[model samples]
Target: MNFSQLQCFVALAETGSFTEAAYAVDLTQSAVSHALAALESELGVTLLERNRKGVVAISNAGQKIIPHVRALLASEAAIEQEARAARGLNVGKLRLGSIESIVSPALLAGVLTSFRTAYPDIEVVLFEGAMHEVGEWIEQSIIDIGFVVLPARGVESTLITTDEMNVLVPYGHRLYDRAAVTLDELYEEGFIMEKTQCMFRLMKRFGFELNKDKPSIRYQASDSATILAMVREGLGITLVPRTMLPKKLEGVVALPLDPPQPLKIGLAVKAQQTALRGTTLFVQTALSWAHEHALLQTVSS
Candidate 1:
């Protein structure tokens, strides 16, 4: 019935134990039990069945109540944030999830600098993660906004920017001599690619399936610098977003992929839902920055 009680119940359901749930919600075990009992008595239904082993949701009671509890908590938090913001002070936290490679020190520093200059009192929290993990964060409302590559299959977002995916190879590599390389041209070459959903979609776009067994997979890595480093050492070649490459990764050459296989970058928010004020501002700033800087337009193209 009460927000505190619902909080306790949700925590208990997630943790599967009274002790663990109490620790998670910062309450004592007896306090958590009391709250759950109060909530069930008010609803006239049992929410959880607990025993020596653990707790389980026995009926539709738990399922029916959870969404309500989650919504209530979210709104309550939003209210608090609104109250703080109404004081003419930017004091609430902003949770932004982004791909690790895209959030390099330079880009992050620039974004933070611009954000702080505008909203000096606002606190920004950055979460660096893989594209898949960041998507989950956005879906769960754990993050207010995210900078990710598209086409994200299920999320609704605005296209903030798009960067071309270029082949970075060693200076003397066979493909480097060509004015532009095609997917078929590199079909037999070794490739170091990011192991993400984007990679799969990109491969699908190229009409080729990635095979690890192709004797040419000389190196495998997730970071662009590492991939380029490996390429510099003649380990193998990689296809990376053009924005991700540092200006001075020595001994490496970036070439256009014929027909241009580009990585569409965008700011993803919770699809079809209202956004928080802070989140809205961040998304707007990001889009403005991308457009003003012509970040989406590739120099090579």
Candidate 2:
């Protein structure tokens, strides 16, 4: 019935948890419960149903109301969006950061161009760094937002893309012509670990040790370019996210792993940056561009 009630209702419906909804909307669980109860009472129907299995979902009657409720919320958001868009033209600045791998294939330039078209006055400053550096910047409030691999720390995120992990081998390597590479075959080769931490990150996703055998580490570098160069020279092979591979595969071939490991990427910001005008616009623009280009798919809600 009121703004807070609407917000709480949407949060509860989406999260399906009193505790999670409370945390999401920044309210006490009791407050969330009270607000939902009041709204249901006013509407003369129970929206959320619960049972003995500790289950919760939208009630039959609630399903009918949800569409209208969502429309109301969407209209309200449009009103606010218009105001923000107008003010965005007057003055704004956003500091953006990203792990280097996501830059080119993400078509980040399209996002930037769209954002600039939408808010010509807003200035976007970009910082490229390793995964840890980006996380550190977000935590320190050094950058307003960034593209981070999900299950990330220190920031809230909305998933934007998932790039598959691939094994990069030199042109004439024995496995170069293979469709896929197995973990055993991969670990046997000398690894040129890059600073991106792709192995450990994907390891966490798969819940396993990627380099369990202490595979020979022929080289390590902070940049993917250096690692790729080493790979080209037959020094060692490395795991590279598909998004990071060069358009022309002259030096290395990117082969999918037998059981594909996915790299989930998201547009992330410090919790406080969510309310920034420039940051909000950039996020919106990036998502819109990705969706239009068929460059995005959600890994999780």
Q: Candidate 2: which pairs clash?
A: none
Error of 2 at 125 (Å): 1.1
Encode model 1's per-residue lDDT on 129-248: one tens digit a residue. 877888887776656778777777656787776677677889899877777878777767876766553554565666757666652455557666677777898878887667767877
| RMSD to true structure for each model, in Å | 5.1, 13.7
**Least accurate stretch of 10 residues (summed lDDT) in model 2?**
292-301
**Which candidate leads the pack in lDDT?**
2
Model 1 compared with the native: what TM-score?
A: 0.72
Worst ten in a row by lDDT for model 1 = 194-203
Please provide, for model 2 over 117-218, each residue's C-alpha lDDT reduced to its tens digit, 9 standing for 90 to 100.
878877787888877788876765556688887888768988776678788899989999999987767556778886566565565466545555656667
Q: Model 2 Cα displacement at 26 (Å)? A: 37
lDDT of prediction 2: 0.74
Error of 1 at 116 (Å): 2.2
